[model samples]
Target: MTQEDKINWLKENEPILWANTFKIAKGELSDKQTMFCCCGKLATGLHEDNCRKFLQQVKNETAKRLQEYIK
Candidate 1:
């Protein structure tokens, strides 16, 4: 997806993630699922998934910004 689309998608999905993250932080959930909630890797596979998604977003947005600059 385009950077803008991806960014908007993130923004929209952030609330759900944020709430879940809070629960994780409060010990209501496992760290494995919410480890990446604060930008750190979780012990579970979920952290890996979040890491990949975060990296993809960063990469896409960086490329998009670069392209805009080149223009």
Candidate 2:
């Protein structure tokens, strides 16, 4: 999927993931923080995913669309 597509997917399918990731990116949340996620596990973590897929998509962004998804 394209970067925008991946981001949109996260926004739609993984809201808590999206919000916390942005928080980490903006330094508003600790990278070490852990919270319950809708993924039905202990955490989606402070990051999006471990595959680096999302990171590869957003890391180079100079104007990263920090839009928090709400569904």
Candidate 3:
């Protein structure tokens, strides 16, 4: 509830959190894209914010592709 409590909880649960986060994100990626993402994340380690960024990027691209397909 408190900031300290939140920080402690995150530290204590990081492995589980990391696993679940990757699991869900992996499910969302296409096979090729998933490999690319995994390589990037592994290379970047602590600074990888690609999960969120990639989702936004994919959504935008998908929308653009759909519009092009429709036209």
Candidate 4:
């Protein structure tokens, strides 16, 4: 697949995550919204790269949140 096809596939398959790229790149996410995105993606089985990256981006301050979910 070409780069363009890969881009289109992401947009089509991960619309929510694709739309979030702009906000994520800008580092505009609050702790609450970051938590929401992580949980929502896992609970819904979205599991896109954005979700993993976003979780890692916020991981330091979000250990408590992860603890709650894991326990």
Off by over 4 Å in 4: 26-71
Best by lDDT: 2
Worst 10 residues of 2 by lDDT: 54-63
TM-score of each: 0.28, 0.38, 0.32, 0.32
Model 3 residue runs over 4 Å out of place are 1-29, 34-39, 42-50, 68-71
Clashes of each: 0, 0, 0, 0
lDDT of each: 0.45, 0.48, 0.44, 0.44
RMSD, one per candidate, in order: 11.6, 10.7, 13.3, 14.9
| Per-residue accuracy of model 4 over 3-47 as CA lDDT, tens digit each | 345445555666565555634542544424543564455422244
What TM-score number comes out for model 3?
Answer: 0.32
Candidate 2: count of backbone clashes, pairs at least 3 residues apart or interchain: 0
Model 2's alpha-carbon lDDT is 0.48
The residue-level lDDT of candidate 4 at 53 comes to 53
TM-score of 1: 0.28
Tens digit of lDDT per residue, candidate 1, span 1-71? 66666445544655464344434433432333454443555535455445655445444544443343331
What tens digits encode model 2's per-residue C-alpha lDDT throughout 19-70?
6676556343224335633233444544455425444434323125443342
Candidate numbers sorted by TM-score from highest down: 2, 4, 3, 1
Residue pairs whose backbone atoms clash in candidate 1: none
Please name the candidate that would achieve the greatest TM-score relative to the true structure: 2
